[model samples]
Target: MKNLGARTGFLITLGLVSLCLAPCQAQTQGSGTKSTTASAIFPNGEKGSAQTFTGTVWVQNLVATDSIYQLASGSVTFEPGARSFWHSHPSGQILLVTDGVGYHQLKGEPRQTIRKGDVVKCPPKIPHWHGASADSPMTHIHIVPNTEKGIVNWLQAVTDAEYHGAR
Candidate 1:
């Protein structure tokens, strides 16, 4: 009787594990016509230019537009005290926080602290900047939808006073 109970418990656990992994497997497998696992992974990102950023920042392109979608996405990493210059997306932007702590601020507004798992939506043409906090490195996935106008409009750099004020 005890052996039967143990076998039942093991089966239940195995079923639960399979259920948990099913979605992941499905995502990689895709439909018979298409494979979703065709996306490329960039381990080391390219350095962000100093002209548009402060300190050290790296960006890795993840997904680029195809015939079906006019969107581009990338993972950006910011070192301590690093940040992007004020900019805006023509069609809007989404930032998905993946690690560490950071800050986001819209023009003329107070800075907001952002941590892992936070999702920030910046409306179309709304000037803003985001970056790692003064003491920590931060990483986020940035999604920008391409519009007829363009993806982004670069603006002035965030002043040192502004960055320090957030801390």
Candidate 2:
């Protein structure tokens, strides 16, 4: 009889905990059309875990949502000799290099080596690409404005010839 009573009490406690959490979960997913401000209504949740691809590259998307224009922010890690495709943003981009060395270039200009503590801004509608150098991995935070039209407009892949062409 004592064991039965203990089992019943445990089940009741579990039910109560579930009931408490259900509302919070629902609010997180279904708080749309509320009059509350965006920041007040939606607190920034924790960023998702890092994802590393087969190449020595990793990315963590910090923010990407339908209703936000502050844009999609992410951290990109590039392996030595790895680079992104030639790309441009509708509203420009900002990059902060956190570690190692890399290269960045706007089209029609010389590529520049980027080191730690460097902050780069690619002007709106400019064609540019950034990535790890031939001998060092580079990590940078990328910020691109989110737009109702499109955030990123990708062009051809960054050719190895272009990546290694000049300083």
Candidate 3:
């Protein structure tokens, strides 16, 4: 537990600091109400393609993967019930849940409920999927390392059964 606080509290502080420093944009729902976002720091970047996501999803690119750093950072926001297709990272990925309730599952493992201040470390090459819960929106900052080997290998979408079934 030595670095647990660092991973959670310090990370949150850092995120907030970055959020204040980064350019941000307002997000409005179809109903015209202001909505909380995935990375409150960055603006809603691009809408995730239907092939890569189930429902409405927004992805904001932060740090671009470059040869020198070989890393990528981004924030993803999911509307209620939105989720990504099953995917794997060549190296690995870390998820910092900044807001709302959500689910994360690795292939063959029971799903885990995640919320604000939670940190999820996904192992290399492990197939997994994550998104907002049925009734709540969610957002997380994803940090991918070792991008020189490739970032992610996207697979099939998580079926409704796979997503809504028992944890």
lDDT of 3 by residue, 92-129 (tens): 89999987799999999999999989999999999999
Tell me the TM-score of model 1.
Answer: 0.73
- Best candidate (score: lDDT): 3
Which clashing pairs does model 2 show? none
- As for model 2, its CA RMSD to the true structure in angstroms is 13.8
Which prediction has the highest TM-score against the true structure? 3
Tens digits of per-residue lDDT for model 2 on 140-160? Answer: 888877555467777776667
Sort by lDDT, top down from the best: 3, 1, 2
The C-alpha TM-scores of every prediction are 0.73, 0.63, 0.77
TM-score of 2: 0.63
48: Cα error in model 1, Å: 0.7
Model 2: how far residue 47 lies from native, Å: 17
Q: Against the unseen true structure, what C-alpha lDDT does each candidate score?
A: 0.84, 0.72, 0.89
Selected candidate, larger TM-score, 1 vs 3? 3
